[model samples]
Target: MNEVQTIDELVISFENHLRSLQRSRFTIRQYWQTWKPLKIFISANNIEFFDITVGKQFIKSKLGAYEYANLNQMQRRLVNTVDALSVFQQTGKIHFGSAPLRRNPPKVFTGEIGILMEGYINFRKTTFGLAKSTANNNIRSLYTLFLFLEDKGVQKIDDISEVYILFFIKNLNPSTLSVNHSTLGVVKGFLKYAYEEKVFSTDWSKIIQRTNYKGQPKLPSFFSTDEIKSILNSIDRSNSSGKRDYAMILLAIKLGMRVSDIAGLKFEDIDWDKHVLTFTQFKTKKSITLPLLPEIGNAIIDYLKYARAVSDESHCFLQQLSPYKKVTAEDVSRVARFYIHRSGISLKERKHGAHALRHSFASELLGNKTSLPVISEALGHGHTSSTMFYLRIDINQLRQCALDVSLVPSTFYQQKGGFVS
Candidate 1:
């Protein structure tokens, strides 16, 4: 049989394997999707799985086509192909497959970081049960670090010295990218974790200290109470999508959840009787339970009962169009952006996107004199320092405590050249 027929057989056999493993229908479909490209790429090249060198060559050729941003996705698909080949080999489903992909573990220098990344990826997949975007983010960060190390001529975990980290930090431009303190913190955390775990003995933390410059702190762009009212008013909730959009926007504002968390929400995540919503945070690898406030619960209930589309998909949010599927992270951002524009907000502030609603929630809480720890927990942040960022944006609360005084005192008015001048 030709390549197409061979691929079909492979897919059939893989589906059987997946079914045997008790994989969900959605996941089985994703596996087929991941496999199709590899089969097509191989067929076009007139190669069989037994020719491991050809597969390796094809992977290398395609590597250049993917830019830095897309390499992780391409790599994942390639990895999956390797996994499928392994399954075929073990099950006697295909005789020509060699499973050339070694699945080399990751570390700091000697490809150990790849192993480090895989640990995080597996944790996200199994423990936290994060959605694809979050797992992708955590994986991407580790991959980027590996790429950085490769560029620096550090090929093993032991090679990652304090000097190398210092150089990386010093060379990073925080202003243009707007990723100064946050990037530093991520790197510091990773290194510290690695060091303390004895994955690497080097004290990279001492060299890659947090910058004292403070850089330009980003003021979290959140809607003021009045602005929130105006934005909500702009939503035309008579239509189905309007109702759904309104519900989503309201949910974020009221609960202080990330857009990723909202998009990944399922029906089972919410508890009506207990007035609670529970889910695992993808970023921090922690399970969280939040009390479903009356307003949020009511909004979601209304949407599910009236506005939500009928679909087999378990996700709470779905696309408005036919063959409706789960709403993506991009969809969340786009919907929020559209309304932000409609509300006559500045374009500069629109970059905050759906996340601004969460920030708005935190700001409002801080304004109400809520403790930082409380706000941090509500926002699912691992540290209070992260939530403290919103405290600066609570200008209304600050105004209440400020001592109002005339700038020009009577004593200063008498001496024109003394103080006023």
Candidate 2:
């Protein structure tokens, strides 16, 4: 590796690399500012290579002088710099440690288990043609399993017993059915693969029972109509960020578009003349088209014409700050949360993310007696069953399904108070 002659050169190269990756200019500037102090410390000490010892010394020196806030900020920046340097030195590639999915498992699992995990991930991708997100989840699940094994001092895959598997299952959050089911599903899939590959003598997959979680159809948490209105009103449409957020929230509430789809929305997806919006569902991969309500269309137009940052990128929503890349799903959620918080609407038993807006949309439609199939189509649900859960919250519809107790014999009702013949 070519040694960085000067910290200035390294900073320049890192800044350029960040720009190449389309990192926001604000982020790049922050990184640069953070590195400046480190540069001074390194140059003063004549540190040749940035290593853990240098990092420790830098922290130790600054911890006493810097204020709490400044010190916290410096620590984060230093860690980011170290990560960037390490990646560059090892792979000859510039990575900002932004992609969690691309990260490898803990170093302890780098032996036999790691090889098997890699092979299993490849098998899932090539054999099953699973989505990148799904494959990533599977790999992460195996990593968790191996991490647990390492913690318990079991190194080899052959040494893994049913007791270890049961212990792992027991450790999962029992209240969270989805997490338990998904984790167990991935582990079992890996075990089956291992058995087929002769890594295990017996089919341990068969021994690991599926999670027996027959959970009730829980009502989807959503804001009330007034709360939704308050959230929308809370956004300061006078600014670019507010305008963008207002449009994104409308898309979620009016159309029930998933956060992912809203983040991935492009200019071409909307036809103003036709008053239609179309996009492929991120989760289901199904193409869906919906009528562009005047309210939603107007919000989007205000954002596009007045507020959206000028960028060559085609994504409908761009970050307010420089680099101005497309907004991510997490960004969409944050926007929702910010407005919801600003609105001062206290949510006790409901989610406050962008998805709550989606649930609100579904609840509104169901309240208006919209057919399940129509609501399903509107929400871009791949199956009507996916939409059925929303019905659990439709009290009016549920009331309609209730049996008319008034028709029952008086003897049947009065028998509890006094025995009636």
- Best model number under lDDT: 2
The true-versus-predicted C-alpha distance at residue 124 of model 2, in Å, is 2.9
User: Candidate 2, 391: how far from true, in Å?
Assistant: 5.0
The superposed Cα distance between candidate 1 and the true structure at residue 306, in angstroms, equals 3.3
Off by over 4 Å in 2: 1-109, 126-133, 170-178, 214-218, 390-421
Question: What is the C-alpha lDDT profile of model 2 across 1-421, one tens digit per residue?
Answer: 4454355665566677777889997888777666778888998998876644465467546532121222244454665565565455445467744622123324334778778888888888888678667876786677778767776778887888889887877765444566557778888999999999999998889866866765455667888899988998898988888889999999999999888999999989999899998887787677999999999999999999999877899999999888998999999999888898899999887678888888889888877777777887898877777677654645567554344466777668767556775
Q: lDDT for model 2, on a 0 to 1 scale?
A: 0.75
Steric overlap count per candidate: 12, 0
For model 1, residues 96-205, the per-residue Cα lDDT tens digits are 33343534334332366667656645754787677675555555455556666676778777777877777776655433243445555656667776777788777576
* lDDT for model 1: 0.68
